[model samples]
Target chain A: MESKIRVLVGKPGLDGHDRGAKVVARAFRDAGMEVIYSGLHRTPEEIARMAVDEDVAVVALSILSGAHGSLVPAVIEGLRQDGADDVLVLVGGIIPKADVPALEQAGVSRVFGPGTPLETIVAYTKSHVRRR
Target chain B: MDERYLTLSGIPIKNCYRPDDTRQLDYARDLADPGNYPFTRGIHRDMYRGRRWTMRQFSGFATAQESNERYRYLLKQGQTGLSVAFDMPTIMGYDSDHPKARSEVGLLGVAIDSLADMEILFSQIPLDEVSTSMTINAPAAVLLAMYIAVGEKQGVASQRLAGTIQNDILKEYIAQNSYIFPPEPSLRIITDILSYCAKEVPRWNTISISGYHIREAGSTAVQELAFTLADGMAYVEAGIARGLAVDDFAPRLSFFFNAHNDLFEEVAKYRAARRIWARVMKEKYGAKDPRSWRLRFHTQTAGCSLTAQQPENNIVRTTVQALAAVLGGTQSLHTNSMDEAWALPGEKAVTIALRTQQILAEESGVAQAADPLGGSYLVEALTDEMERLAQEYFDKIDRLGGVVSAIEKGFFQQEIADASYHYQNRVDKDEYVVVGVNRYQMEENVEIPLLSVGQESVRQQWKRLERVRSERDGQEVRRMLEDLKECAQSDANLMPVILDAVRSFATLGEIMGTLRSVFGEYREPARF
Candidate 1:
């Protein structure tokens, strides 16, 4: 069998609201992924380093505190600088529809908001993750 | 050929309830008369008729002047008290200009950096007349000190000021995660606040031990009651450990809870909270004062219950939750705006939210009685069961060596995560229903005029901070910060020194930064 999809769920910036992060992390685990959690208040450099160190195939970012406008792009930049550019990036939590296109253009594979079912996220990850 | 009924918390419900369900309920011991011991009915004799619950809408966004306008407008629209929601940067103890606060200044709440901002925020509003509640934690002592300094500026002494600081740090570690220092230093700061407020800010509620975030983080109603009471008991113990008398600070310790969609379960949870706290204070802690036994709490309709889709349905959800709060006998309430799930509520949405409370108070007559659902068999039975269910958690937490130890062990975090995931899984499978998200089919082109926050406040707040930094007596600011750090290093209460720093125009970031250097920052180990 193929190795389980390795994913790192990150909470960047000063946003401590992690209900989405924890719940989605649990969902990822239940879907048989090897999950790594970036605890609250992680900086972009720290998250990218963890993604590289853990050799995770995917990095999911959760930000509810409205700092996603700045934090998300910083993490993407950090990953590129570290030569982990091919790692799939996903975003969730309180991103307005207007901001989606920019995040997508910046290398985020998908963006989920409030009320998304866990199965949808799991299914999407399984189908899209580039396993190492 | 069977149908299953369940509450939002996943408690199985009977098809019909009967008097036999509560046959053993003793009116005297279990369900005492209002204002009596074990106040399961209500804390006051005539709830809302004698003095109605305070309508304190939580509002703040952008800079001081703009937020002041919103506060004045809410007051003019008949809001009885003020609840300030500080921005995440302010909430995390950073100046608006701090690089870490980029793109987030004045996003969700108002940015207050110094006594100058506090003065402008509360300008033209009398401190003595209007009681204010600040939803601030982590650096609560500094903010409270600034408020006291503002009162002094207004000729209102610290003694005359009345309000609450959500100085509850334990909940921040468990759920909110805006915590700065680790558990030990945080509890020490809380103890200092309790002791300081007991003497200086007498009318001020020192700590609002909160369960609102716990519920919002997806715990069941029973877990909310259990964990909250656990945190409250931990505070009371901390005060006692500090050699302060129980009654000295216990009476002022208040609670804040979430009014979720489970009407009967939520009511039962509140009712159970009162009974449990009363007994714990009287019997376990040896608190002699009746005020110490009486549980006073404020309820806010659950923000998590509201949906981004079909936002209008949130009005109905909030109304149901508000009715539950009123029936459950809350001391005050804040009805959530229908548009909150999408953004900070627009003026029209917040007004309707406030009006929802007014209509209930005026037209619905739900507030006429102390405990409207006090006699229902289902409610009584559920109230009894809630206590029992909560007892299960109390035992587990006690075995884990109290709230702090459990938090260190990630007990509460894991439990809440499991509960939240369970709930979402149910909704995913159509086992449970959330109105707009799952049950109702609708193609929503939502155009609710959102309260759009802009970058202007960031510029405004940065300029104000710059001016304050330059104009203040830098020598005195440095001296006060040194004194505050020295005080934080000792066992002496930090509040008095914090007040001195605030008077010297020491910014919140400066004060918190000083303490952070001494106490160190808390980093929770992340796990699934």
Candidate 2:
């Protein structure tokens, strides 16, 4: 049997709005995937290091403070520097439609907004997780 | 035919109700006249007939000058009170120029670095004439000092300053995650503010013990009530432990609650809240003053309930929520704007939000009587059920050695996380129907313009900080921060030193940084 798919859920920057992050952590767990939450107020470097150290297949970030334009790119770059760029990067929060194409161009696999069904996220992760 | 069933709190409902539901209620014991003891019916005898609840719209964004213009416009639009929302950096006690604050400046709320910014934020708006509520925690003393300094600049005395500082730090550790200091030092700062404001800013509410964030973080209504009241009990215990008299500072204590979707259940939550608070303040703490016993609160409609899918439908959701708040007898109310689920509200959206309260006050006759649903069978039974559930939580919290220990053990966080997951699972399964999201689907994307702040606002904020730094007396600022640091290390009241630091033009970052160094920072456990 294949080992459980490990995923790291992170809350970047000083954004304390973690309702989505916590719920997604539980949803991923309920989906039978192992999840590691980076807790709150984590820097981009801390999150990237955790994703690399844990050898996770997915690095999902939740940002609601509208700092996604800067923070998400920084996390992606940190992963590149650590030679962990193959990790699937999933973003969630109050991301604007106009910013989506740019985030996708910057190596984000998907950006989920509020009210997106949890099954949608789970199924997307299952189908889209980068194979080792 | 529609399938009907349970309340938002998972309370199973019956098809019909009768007088038998509330047959055990004693009007004299459970509820008296509106203004009488226990205050279950309502706090005021006449309720809105005597005076309408203040329509407070919580808003702040861009630079100080820009936010000031918004406040002036809101006042002109007949908004009864001012509620300030600070930026994420300001909320986290960082200067605008800090590396952590780079992308966050003025993105959500007004950015304040020092007294200079506060002066501009409240410019031309006299501090004494209108009441203001600052939704600030952790660094509440530093921000309150800025408000006092602004009041002084306007020639308003501290005695005449009337407002509430969101000084409830326990909730910060439990829910909001904006806490700067450890729990012990944080409580010390709150206790000092309680005694200090009791003497100086007598009309000012010292701490707005808040359940608003708790509910917004996705706890059930009962958990919101129980944890908030449990936190309130902890503060009272802290005050007494500090040797302050209960009646002296308890009267100024206030509460903040969230108005959610379940109208009847929300109303019952408020009624139960008031009765539980009155009994605890009078019976448990042995307070003689009736004012100390009364539970006064401000309510904001639940932000989590607003959907980002169909923005227009939020208007109706807000209407139901605003009506519930009024019917539940909230002292002041904030109805969330339609665009809030995506970003900070724009001018047009906030205007509609403020107008929601005005129409409810002027057009709706629900406010004509005090507690119109006081004797209803369903409402009364719900109120009792709410009270019973809250007691169970309180007992559980006490068994765990109170709220502080529960927090240290991450008990509250785990409970809230579990509940939040349950809510999400329900929504995902379509067992819970959020119109426009799960049920009444909308295919076309919304075209309403949202308020988005670019880097220009951050540059504007940085320029103000540069001027504030270049102009102020650096030596005096250092001296005041040193005094604050010393006070933090010792048992002295930190408020006077904080006020002096604000007077000396010490920035919020400097004061909070000084305290952060002395009291240390908090890092949450990485438990999911």
Candidate 3:
């Protein structure tokens, strides 16, 4: 029996643009990963709670509201405080290039922006999960 | 690779289109002359020949004072009209000082907390001299009321105001998830706006039935048209059910569409939309006034199509999309800035975007003719096919008990998700070509100076919000909010009370909270 990789895809804050989040979630499902989608307007605490509750290997945060600077750190901290620090965090959506380094420093393993191929994201997730 | 040909909507395209392809299309009934019934050629006979479409660039960011400066600058730079973009907090009906709004205040767009913010937003710009379009929903009534109050303060009569409020909430459920109220009460607020604007603000376009967000959400051109028109039908039905005459409110109805990369398909989509809307308004609803049937729409270049890699290529992409919009006969067009894929556009990039429209309208002779691609065999065939596919979708939506019910059942959401996934899959497989991304790869670093909203603006906005709260009459605000909550409990039009609240300087969050107490919040059902 194969062990399936579980991932929780979350949208935090007030950003309603979810095309990227939904597409990535579908890609994960097609890649044979068990995916849980945290629907729109979720707070960081709620997303982190769902990540712990789902006991997922990966927690992907998607936000296009430009609030990622503040929200992404909060989510990462929430996960750390909730003792889910082992879960890998990934970020995507309309994040600026300048902000990517700060987000990485805050513990986002990867930041995918517009025009990023889903295969790249899938491959990155698989490799990171395997290493973990 | 096998040679496959199809529109983005998955409609197979022939190698060559001939007269036989459109044999079923009657010129008199289907492809009538421009500005006539069942307007397929174009909505206006003169089209751009008489007056070019309004070059209204959607611009807003940081504080209202900064956004107002940008608006004034754009007007000085030859922008014909103003289209305001609100931040996520404003769009979600949260006050700037709210904890949930912290970090999001004026991030994506300007944050408006109350009538004070709206006044600052329109300062120095004479309301009667210019038109404004606000991209707001959920709390659209509150924003529109604020606009009306601003106009009154500027000494402009309500009847003299000419602009549009993107009051289309159905698409919020379908594509954008920024909705505040549930479906039933959302439609009621929309109908109330339609009724109120028809009687009081006679010149105002109450709602802009939008397909822009639908396309941005990854739906195909055909789905954008189909879902948007279906939503428009639902609004009309709601208004008629509320005892308002169809013609009374239909004339103020407008549309908004997206101009994607496929120029021919996009032109065909616009043409088919006008034809179908004209037919629906006349044949189905029995609208006698021609203005009611004329499907005037605003177009914005597709933001999803813009690329972060070799961002300069986005200018060319925006130009192509803007040309398609002009060729398709958009009443107004907004060209997306190149830097948008990364962050809010800087000054230089936004100016170039405005220039893209000006060059298309002035230098390029594409706007001289009405529907330049009207009689082309391929365009005509594509137009007919788009109409047929959209009609099929309309029938399916009708069978599911109309747009609102279909939304509740997650029909539109599922379809968009499927389409978006398919598109992404193609890109992943290298089946689709996105220049500078999957193809023509580059290793050069992006060197554009991205615009960053400073923390000072957020602090200032918070301070301003606190000042408004302290300065406003507390008694009047409380009384008006009470009245608004009471009105929300009943079927009485909430617009009047909402306007009263706006006039009393009730904050957006306060007003939305009152209504939320009555209408309750909406929780979207699981899609997948």
Instruction: Estimate, for each residue in B7-69, the C-alpha lDDT of model 1 and write its tens digit.
Output: 788777888899899999999999999998899998989878899999999999999999999
Q: Identify the runs in model 1 with alpha carbons over 4 angstroms from their true place.
A: B1-3
Question: CAPRI verdict on model 3?
Answer: medium
List the lowest-lDDT window of 10 residues for candidate 3 chain B. Answer: B1-10
TM (chain A), candidate 3: 0.96
| Per-residue lDDT of model 2, residues B49-157, tens digit only | 8888988999898788888999999999998899999998999999999988888888878899999999999999999899999989998998999999999999999
Q: Better model by DockQ, 1 or 2?
A: 2
lDDT of 1: 0.91
DockQ of all models, two decimals each: 0.72, 0.80, 0.79
**How high is the CA lDDT of each candidate model?**
0.91, 0.91, 0.91
True contacts kept of 1: 0.70
Model 2, which residues run further than 4 Å from truth?
B1-4
Colliding residue pairs in candidate 2 = none
RMSD of each: 1.3, 1.4, 1.3
Interface RMSD after interface superposition, each candidate:
1.3, 1.2, 1.1
